[model samples]
Target: MADRSLESEQSWKALDGEQMSALLRGSLNDYGAPPAASAEASERFRLQLEQSDQDPMDAFVEAVAGLTDAVERLAEIAAKDPLAAAASIDPSAADYAEIESLPKPIRMTVRTWLGRLLVRSRLYDEALPVIAEVDATESIDPASSLFYRGACYHALLMKQEALTDLRTLLENEDDCPIRFSRLAKLMVADIKPLKEDSLDEISRLMTDVTRRLDLGRSDEKVEGQEQKIIDKLTKLIDKLEEQQQQQQQQQQGGGSSGGDPKNGQESPMQDSQIAGGSGDGNVKKKNLGDDDGWGNLPPAERKEALQKISRDLPTHYRDAIEAYFRKRATDG
Candidate 1:
């Protein structure tokens, strides 16, 4: 809900090169090398390499494709062998210079897979530069690159930069994978408070509440409460802006006879109270849904009804409703 100018203001700026390099080097040293490939993986790679004799690039692509699959297979074996999945694909085994020399498309693919593997393994700092590299090239699954870069920025405590990237993904990449968009919104919500973008945060929450209501995925009582909060915040912002305009006018009229508060002028606080007090009770009653059906439901009956309906709702929505009730219970 930020205006276009605000959105433009949030554009991403890369971290300082020297600082980023130092951080990556430190993280890599701390993490050390990835565990060597398990025996099964080694044999599979050997066979894959043999098959690639006709085309080395094809073999490399095959190896990259199998990387995640190999980890999953190792995990299955580890369930029984206890040590079978202890090893991971070591990224250092790849010759960076040789990969750099490959065709553009193939090189980008390798970097993309490598970046993803590093991120999945929680080597966020190491993944940061790799993701940035791909992002610079504007190739190799750009959506994934942006997501992982935002994640890396988040992990590194570069929250402003993280918000910039995550917001970009959320706003501009509708065709991006759903999971990435969802995760970006969650991260934005989490980071907004820290950045003091309270209005923007509230706007996002309101948007989400409205969307759920449209989708029939919200509890009536919860939806009403969220709407009430939105209304209250909107009113509050309007009131503050009015006060600001009055102050600015007074400043401009400082040399005029009526400008001085000391000259029998009313205090702004008193003026605001006089203007607002008459409507406060009415606003509160409306927000509390004094005449709404959901507000009239008995607590026990409401809980029972919600539980009965939950079985038919999607898992995500059901979880959201449950969480809402839990929070309300705790708040009460």
Candidate 2:
């Protein structure tokens, strides 16, 4: 018998949210009135309460209250021990029939408790109908009902419904509890895009920078601003590379790459110097710094020299440089 009980418990836990709810509804429909054996047990319970000088009606009421309190406690425990709570309640228990006939308010409270418990256990589909019933009746706490329903919709991948409920709670921020309001706001933000097509915009900006630099028509201030944009683009590329590597690692079931090779920490000007001539056997090394003959040119001539140097670098290196300058202009 104990082994059979364990098997039943395992089977219940193995079911999905929809299957669990179906089983629960079926059990409620099939439940019967208290049997002769249970009636005898209740009589003994009443007699024991009477021995303490309690009125018979009061004793019965107290016993019913105690049972309700126990159910409430079990609902709380269900958050962490959903399978245990589900298995603990015998489907054939006689009292379940009486529970089906409970007052409307009491039934709503019970549904609210069960709905939240199912949600906490990650049984979103099972929670939805119960939560919806409570919400339709408008008997349960409004903030709690909204949060649970919103969370269920999110888990079920119904993004629009989730956003609507979450936003509604946020709109009445003063009426809603602080915790629920804050959570709704977080959910809404998470659903929204981080930026408006940022990658495409980055590519377009880089192209514009290349065109401007190619013209070689800039003053000292414009040249400085262009240099800053190049730096920003380099950083953006590094960040995008890191994100790609992290995704690949996750897909491969490996740990993080820890460090990505494409993430360049060196300044664009320094990188360009190294890439252009530092180690190339066929190319003559030239001092790229202002301390070299570069400082001798007038402001306009210096700017033109810098632009010619930028145009001559490899395309990938040039893009990184251009992006850095473009970012500076936007930020400034």
Candidate 3:
């Protein structure tokens, strides 16, 4: 009898030709795949093996992709309605309920592939439900399921969950695929320092907004996310301005107020910095950068623009102006 314990310990990374052959045949049998389909898949697997000495994980992924294609085709054939084919292409569609009729092993493989497909398509929200169905430890390719699910989580900004799966993938360094481990490591690093509603979070949200727009999605959800970014930016700017005002106040209180006969050195505390204008009309404009509403400009022009915003605009009006300019830039 074969060593059941040894077979259980066998990692995909260590599988040789004979072992892989047996695995393919066993999986096919377990799924009760048709004889003709089995023959074709076997031939394709043999050709894939011969074409290049691919990593076992790579080979496993290709095999699963093939299985998904076969399953989709089978679903198409079994489907009475012509729309079933279209539904198969969309993960959100209900026609994939046919996959529930498949045997356990086949269903897991199909779901894993669907999860990966949705992630690659940048459909992180749609991918999560499908990916959550597979337990990584029990998956045929643990590394693949773990990495892709973690990736989907990371893309959706689920930091802790992403870190959980990614860190788990890295824990089994010897058994895990090198490519996946490396990517997981990078994603973990990216997610580590992110704090809620901070500028970094807003930047990530901006990136997500851009990604959605690129995908031709301008739905209410996308617009809502955009509004969140604007709100965050407004809060951040308000906090910064508060800090700057406090610093100016501190500097003013420290200086000799009545004996200011200094020649070209402007007063550190200017009435112009205060919230409403004094009759003097001397307002100072803060500097701007790439992140601000103003694009890069000559120092003089930047100063001019900042003066326009700071002098005439209220804080909320400034936010609205920034949002309008941002939308214009995006449209262009």
The RMSD of every model to the true structure, in order and in angstroms, is 17.3, 22.6, 11.5
Clash tally, candidates in order: 0, 13, 0
What C-alpha lDDT does candidate 1 achieve relative to the native structure?
Answer: 0.51
- Which ranges in model 2 have alpha carbons more than 4 Å from their true place? 1-100, 192-332
TM-score of each: 0.33, 0.33, 0.60
Q: What lDDT does the true structure give each of the candidates?
A: 0.51, 0.51, 0.66
Residue range 1-332, candidate 2, lDDT tens digits: 33454343221112222332333333223333234433443555445544666533223323334445544444555557754544443346444444445444345445565666777766664577666655423323455666778877765546688887777656556556687778788877765542332443344345444444564535664465455445555565455545554554586654332334487433345333535536546857866776654324455644454466556656765656565556657889
Q: What is the lDDT of residue 91 in candidate 2?
A: 43
User: What lDDT tens digits, residue by residue, belong to model 1 across residues 1-332?
Assistant: 74676446433333322332333233223323233432333344445545545322233345433444432343344346422222222234333343444445434544555555656655554566555565423233456557877877765546788987787776554456788888888888877665332444444455446545664565775567585644545454445445555655687676453434787664445334435444445533335444665423355744555566456756664555555556657868
Best-performing candidate as measured by TM-score? 3
